[model samples]
Target: MNAFMKVQNLHKIYGDKVVLNKINFDLKEGEFLSVLGPSGCGKTTLLKLLIGIESQTSGKILLKGNDISQLNSSKRNMGIVFQNYALFPNMTVLQNIEYALKFHETYKKDARKIALEVLEQVGLTEHMNKRVDRLSGGQQQRIAIARTLALKPDVILFDEPLSALDAANRLTMRQEIKRIQKEYHSTIIYITHDQEEAFTMSDRIMVMSEGHVEQLDTPLNIYNHPKNDFVNDFVVKHLQTKLNDLEKCMVKDYD
Candidate 1:
């Protein structure tokens, strides 16, 4: 299968500091790839580069074999959902979603139709005419997602999108996101520090640390056979106590 997106030796620098270092990866069409990392690990920076919000200091980004390294943000054909929802306070829920489709010359009327459908998918159709300020955090997050979907972009990049919601709402939204992505058959690059969220939502997970990718594999493989001490420590730190104890027993067999 052809890769829908590819990053080759990507590097990003902010003056004297490096934000991303020699990053390389690829996403197949309809794949859900979660980038798992702690804060300040450059995961968000990677998302920004993919969407053209930030430029890479070196290397190339290819979307379906077209180099998009110098493409304008608006031309990237990628949708992004930020942690803060990024909704316009004055716009109604439906209007906010419709805004994303304004640039698509062929889809003006269809945009509204699609936006409404996405709102319904997110359980926010009743809130369509309501201003963003009136909605709860979860509701606003759903609006953000709906807005992104309205663009019908080739790829979706989510930057810690569920971080601002409560636990219950986060869980609900996580499942909704998974379902929506599959429904659209969209390639997704999701960034989150939450291990459980990554494991639950990702078809594959890339563990990043200190501006580099430490490992990329299926969640089960990441948990069972971490490549290095850092990954092993992270797995132990994040796993439940029972699971941690089980890992110890499993490790003994390897010893």
Candidate 2:
């Protein structure tokens, strides 16, 4: 597939300090690409730049061969689902989902219909009448995703969306998100520090460090053939440790 979105020679600078250093990547349509890295690795900064919240010091952000790096956030036609869920607590799920659609000319006329459709897409139709604050974490997250879907964005960006959930809820939401992506035919850029989360959900994983991409490839290839010490130590070794711990627990259970 052709590159649906491209970030080339991207750089972000705050005074004398550089936050992102000549970063580059290509994203395909309807692909789930996870940006995996530890905290303060410039992953969040990259998201902000792509979404137009932050301007790149230098570089081009091309969407379908058009430069959109300078566009305002609202004009970018990209949706973001934050870790906090960022819903209106007092509003019902239906209202929260309908809120953003009012700003879109094409969707505003049929806001309720679109909202309900997205709510059903995320499997939160039954909770539509409930206040967002009254729902559990997982339900609230689905609402947030449903709200984003209502606008019918070209690309969806997730900023460590499941990091706030408990283990059970996180696992459940993972499946929900993958289903939504497939059914909605969305292109997603998921940001996460969890190796397992990236491995399970992403079509390809982009490993980053200190504002640079360490490796960008399939999860299996990254695991089997690491490009350098950082990729091996950060991604491979960490996943291996988790597997070793799981093996010990399984052996104990059998004994």
Candidate 3:
């Protein structure tokens, strides 16, 4: 299959610092791809470039064979969910979702219908009447996602979206996001530092360090055959330690 979205020789620089260095990748249609890296590794910078919030210093961004490198964020046909749920505290859940659709030329006339539909899609229809600030962290996150889903963009970018949640909420939202993505048949580029989030949710994972890709492959392939020391240490070893700790807890429980 041809690439649904492609980036070639992407780079971002600030004065003497190189934020993203000659990066390149392809994303298949309806595929879930995660950009995993530690802080200051350019994961978020990559997202900003993809979503058109920031321009690349030099590169091409192709969406379905069309060059969108010069397009603004709204013209890119992409949606992004920030780590903080960017919601209106004063608005109802339904209104929060509907508000965004009002600005969308295609959905504006039917904003209410679209908002209601996405609310249902996120399993938040029952909370539609609640004020945004009144909901739990997970519920608020769902509303943020619902608002984005209302626009029905071609691709969605998630930037550490589950980071603010408690461990239990984070796990639950991970499942929620995966389910929503599958149901929507959505193409996703999820940015995260959490190993389990990327491994469990992605069809493919792109590991980056110091602004360059270390590896990009299926989660199983990455885990079993790391491309280099960075992949082994940053991805595999970290996950292994988590597994070891969990096993020790299980052993203690059995005793």
lDDT by residue (1-255, candidate 3, tens digit) is: 779999999999988899999999999999999999999999999999999988999999999999999999989999999999999999999999999788888889999988888888889999999999999999999998988888889999999999999999999999999999999999999999999999999999999999999999999999999999999999999999999999999999999
TM-score of every model versus the real structure: 0.91, 0.98, 0.99
- Number of colliding residue pairs in each model: 0, 0, 0
Cα lDDT of all candidates, in order?
0.88, 0.94, 0.94
- Model 3, position 95, has a per-residue lDDT of 91
Question: Which runs in model 1 stand beyond 4 Å of their true positions?
Answer: 242-255
Could you give me the TM-score of model 3 versus the true structure?
0.99
**CA shift of 139, model 3, Å:** 0.2
CA shift of 100, model 3, Å: 1.3
Per-residue accuracy of model 1 over 1-255 as CA lDDT, tens digit each:
667888999999999999999999988999999999889999989988888888899999999989999999888889889999888999899889988677688778688788888888888989899999998998898888888888778998899999888889999999889889878898899999988899889999999999999999999899888989877777545776656788999999999
